[model samples]
Target: MAVTIFLLIVAAGAILFIYQTFLRDKWIRQKPFPAQHEAILSCNLPIYPALGEDQQHRLKQLILLFLTRKQFYGCAGLEITDEIRITIAGQACLLLLNKGWQTYPKLLSVLVYPSAFRAERDQMQDNGTVAIARHDLLGESWSNGKVILSWDDVEKGVSDFGDGHNVVLHEFAHQLDGLSGSTNGAPPLRSNSYQSWARVFTENFEDLRHRSQRGLATVMDQYGTTNPAEFFAVATEAFFEQPWQLQKARPELFAELQAYYRLDPREWQRSTEND
Candidate 1:
């Protein structure tokens, strides 16, 4: 009897774990999103107001699941609050909307600092030796299930929602880029998309790099010239924040992103502008 009971308990535990792992996300989506959270998004997340009702519904579900799953911590004596969590998650969820992928499946945590923070970097020296240096940063994404951000920068990114330079979007783009392994400007793609994505991104990256070297102005950030990975992230920043400009300036690049993201930011912007 004792052995039978023990076996039963283990089986029950296993079943519970399986349910939580598989069924919980669908369960979360079936529920209504909180109104208070919507208020927070409206006030703190500027992009939320621009999203269409259906997109907003999809994003709200993503945000709710994200808040429940990912942990958030405060650094530099900062305090973590629901408002901060909601705002940050809302911004990050913009990338996940209209996709069936689990909410940042690889991400386990978010770390927020009160302001710009310094981190160490390793640089290759002339003789191939490594030199360590420290640099101040507003945001960073780790392939190991972590993202770090400055609260000040987060606030700035949302406040100027039209600037096409959002740190949250930028770093989260890295998170998505790293999903397929090394973030070499290519994330996992649907069938037959790799060729086009690679071609368009390569041309745009090279164009941006040349223009940046010549100190010419462009719709996409000059910082995108840093590398293929940086180009993808910075271009993602522009993709959502200034879609109209990007669509006008680089229609092919915009189309690739529109297809990948499965949503049109131009429509959102147009709706907002018409209002």
Candidate 2:
């Protein structure tokens, strides 16, 4: 009886330890972020003014989420300021405004560099050998819960959102796509919508590939023609940048993206412009 009582005490202690640890971590993550961080707003994008009062408040909340939940560090002594944090988090949360942003689960860390970063990739040999090569990247995403980006490109991406090239959106889109256990362009989809997404995306992807092969000037980015996965990322950049153009050029593809992202920036632009 004494042994059993001692065992229960041990179990209770273990449970309490775990609970305290979890609570501590959660409390730390919920800490409110400061309003002014030098880096966060350093490179403000022109599009920021278009956000309404409520949207602005939501953006502020997201900045705190990013600061508390993600790990960010500066390279070469580049200090991360509140503005930079807010800027990146605002754009990332833009995609989630109309939908459940939390759908992008499993992502845990974001690493920022002062500029383009270098990484090594291992090449496979025909005889089951591996060769390593160094490569430079503006941004990269890993399935193991990490994202790397260049600060220069991050600012450029925000400013050039209308141009359909954003590193943050591109990488985060990959994260969302990989949630279903693969990095292919196809992420988890509602059962009823998969058929349409597959059909429209495949048809458009193939068409883009064919046009690029023929050296035809395509509406979507030529980089998207590289692969279905890339096509999705590239298209996402374009969708956020030039929504009307995408809608006009590829209505079906635009519709799929609209359904997926749930917020139509084109409409936002129209409403804002009219005001």
Candidate 3:
């Protein structure tokens, strides 16, 4: 009886694995998002046209998977619409392209406000005093499987894809960062690349901090100096939006990002120009 029970358990496990590996993928593919392609084209995501045909199709699949799996909620009296959903999802999924197709497995929901929202937090002072502070925020990513954004900023980010200030990208990068069990600058990287990623990020982060302190002009945003995590998120923004400028100003950092993301936006820009 014990052996028979064990064999039954094994058979059930194999059946479950087969269902997950085959049936789940078929179901996801058949799930319809009729406006997916049109949404991608109309969203004004400059990187969309830069991708090859296969990559573009994969991106659409990722976006559809994102829409299927995650929930979007409107906040602060904002009304959620397909355009808003597609716009935000498209930009967020851009980061997943050429990487694994997991559409932020840990992310479950997105909350969007009509504009910048006020958030209050307890601030720890250098003097060891805690004080309540309120600040306006455009976007935020929480480790609790939630992402919040300002619809206004989302639209702005899409409108000016070359500006290197995408709120969606920035916040989503934070989500990716948090996947490593902590919100530190480091995300899960291959064993071989971790050392190189650390070295390059540390050097560039220090340089940006020093430049900010001296009031020197820098291609990266001053907000990056806030912390290592912010530095990674901000760098991700620049890497995608201002690829040419980032490549010119900080080639090593750009190279590191290229290796990590497995694509080169500079090459995309070149292709765009040539065409």
Candidate 4:
């Protein structure tokens, strides 16, 4: 057992060396966001416009880290340009804007598709039926250094930010949740907040599930009711996009999210409106 463990560690070190020395440069190249990207910074991304000066700078630094650390791969004959990568990275990093940029320390790769991609999902039924099904996915996050997204949907997400649907934010939110060893809605919390986070999340999740089942209007997407993980991601979208609506419709859930994300979009919106 000791010999086997030693060999495994040696193999892991060799793989890391090869990846850093050869495979990484051949696959992805990192570059700073140049001045030209600034036009789209204000054009396609209206969310950044509402942020305060400090927040905007912090978000930019976060984007730079994502660009440098994460590998961007293009699928379906697509070319992964700096523009596409930065735009996607910027939006994904927006989720961490209030939470500190270092929140995404585990992410390493970002795979981008030209459009909606398909994946095989395992489905089990109560009647003893089990099947593998194909799912059309916009984005996905993995604990082991991978996040996948559809580039077209990413553009659409930025274009339609106010509509409360952003695949990038949704998937990155899953990445945060994955930090706790599982993507069951709760991420790694400070020592004092874990129990309360779980309790509030569970209660609100049930409430949202009930509301969804009853056909009631909800501030968060009904897709959230699919699972606790989805609930967190979908709620994140609504929190950033339609903060006032979320606060008015589900004040408790909104408060929980506000505490988690550490930024109040309602305040940003009010300041933007006044300006």
The C-alpha local distance difference test score for the whole of candidate 2 amounts to 0.76
lDDT tens per residue, model 2, 212-268: 999987778898988888989888888887889889989999999998877677866
- What lDDT does each candidate get? 0.90, 0.76, 0.88, 0.83
Q: Whose lDDT is higher: candidate 1's or candidate 3's?
A: 1
lDDT of 3 by residue, 1-275 (tens): 99999999999999999879666766785666576555655556776777888777777788878888899999989998888888888889888888876788789999999999999999999999999999999999999999999999998998888888999999999988888899888987888988999999999999999999999998889999999999999999999988989999999999988887888877767877888
Top-scoring candidate (lDDT): 1
lDDT of model number 4: 0.83
lDDT of 4 by residue, 160-234 (tens): 777889998899999989988899998887888878778877888898889989999877889998999999999
Residue range with the least summed lDDT across 10 consecutive positions in model 2:
37-46
User: Which regions in candidate 1 have their CA more than 4 angstroms from the true location?
Assistant: 1-20
Clashes of 1: 0
**Clashing residue pairs, candidate 1?**
none
Ranked by lDDT, top first: 1, 3, 4, 2
Candidate 2 residue spans exceeding 4 A from truth: 1-43, 101-103, 125-129
lDDT of 1 at 233: 96
